[model samples]
Target: MTYDPTFDQTRLDQLADQCLADNTGTGKVIFLSDDEDNRLELTSWRFEDEEAKARLMKSDFKLYLLELLDTLLVYRAQHKQPNASRGVVSVCKNQMTVQWVSRAEAERLRDL
Candidate 1:
């Protein structure tokens, strides 16, 4: 068997709810429009508990997911073929690959 990362669906739903708390079911990750080569852009996403997001990001599972996502992001950034879209990402309790799907799709998963 191989090692894989997994995320909790309920936690994700809660996170998304928190992020949209003030904005009414909307969130944004802004990309700067400046030419400063090394300047980092500011971004924001609402989460109920800051620690929760921080903990998730700092987890070993997240580290693994980021590694996987990095490859995909790099490919997408290089090609610029497909437009980026908003969605949710989830992982099964006993699965390897992460599942990236739309909000409706996620709702279906949650219902199941």
Candidate 2:
């Protein structure tokens, strides 16, 4: 599958907006996709006053995230290394980062 730069940028923008709306303060959201099991795990943290911190529920943003993930999967399937078992997406404000993880790395993250 060819990479769709336009689709990816749009979905990523939407995801960033969703995160900003859901978080009351500076926040970071991490999404982990387990390709082997077809699962997506989300972890979100909100920081306030450099002291107060809380984990935010990501249910409301799942749809947007899934859309982004689906697009990424298509692109990844065509280009990723065989050993890559997980896709990691990290978002903060309007910035986003994506990377592939090995099965062992995915498991280690899940344990944390």
Candidate 3:
């Protein structure tokens, strides 16, 4: 996934919380602004505790993260386009990373 390191943590993290559907939710991925070269920017979500990882990993955390991220993205996309929260997002019990891009950016990623 491609990304920029300059994203606003507050907003990106808001998207992360939005990704989780629950305030207690931890891991997430969200879109950010594009670079001057037009590449998609990215960010990853993470939990703060080892116990949290242990609990989340007990199940298919990756699958759950993907499902949750997709749900959040589609939900947001309905209201926003272009930088419509599309891109590559990954999660483990420990970390989640998402590339921020347009719908076309996600499409290009799929083609890869």
Candidate 4:
């Protein structure tokens, strides 16, 4: 499978919409995944309450994110980028940024 930037952007937009719908006050949402693993981690916080993070930990958005991550992993594998061991999708104020990073970077973000 090849990477489709447009598709990724569209998916990210949908995810952001879902997050906002789940929590109208959602300020940011982050999705992290390692290409070598099936785990997809999420970090989210409300604009009004940064201290209260992970509000979406148990939200249904995870299922959507998992499917998106699976597709992204397939594309990453086909592209074969050694340094791109992880995929990060971030949404803030309804804007999305998608990136590929190293395992170390992923771990650091996961810890945040």
Which predicted model would earn the best TM-score? 4
Candidate 3 deviant stretches above 4 angstroms: 1-59, 90-93
Query: Which has the greatest lDDT?
Result: 4
Model 2: residues >4 Å from true position, as ranges?
Answer: 1-10, 18-59, 80-84
Ranking by lDDT: 4, 2, 3, 1
For each candidate, the alpha-carbon lDDT, in order, equals 0.35, 0.51, 0.46, 0.56
Q: lDDT tens string, model 2, 30-111?
A: 3455455444444333234233123334354545666567556545555653532354565554455565667676556556
Error of 4 at 10 (Å): 2.1
Ranking by TM-score: 4, 2, 3, 1
lDDT of 3: 0.46
Displacement of the residue 28 alpha carbon in candidate 3, Å: 13
lDDT of 1 at 47: 37
Q: What is the lDDT of residue 31 in candidate 3?
A: 38
TM-score of each: 0.32, 0.53, 0.36, 0.60
Which residue pairs clash in candidate 2? none
lDDT of 4 by residue, 1-112 (tens): 5555576677778776766454533343334544255344443332444432345446666567667766666565666655434656654544566777676776676667
Candidate 2: Cα lDDT at 36:
57
The list of candidate 4 runs beyond 4 A from truth reads 22-54, 81-84
> Which RMSD values do the candidates have, in order?
12.2, 4.8, 10.7, 4.1
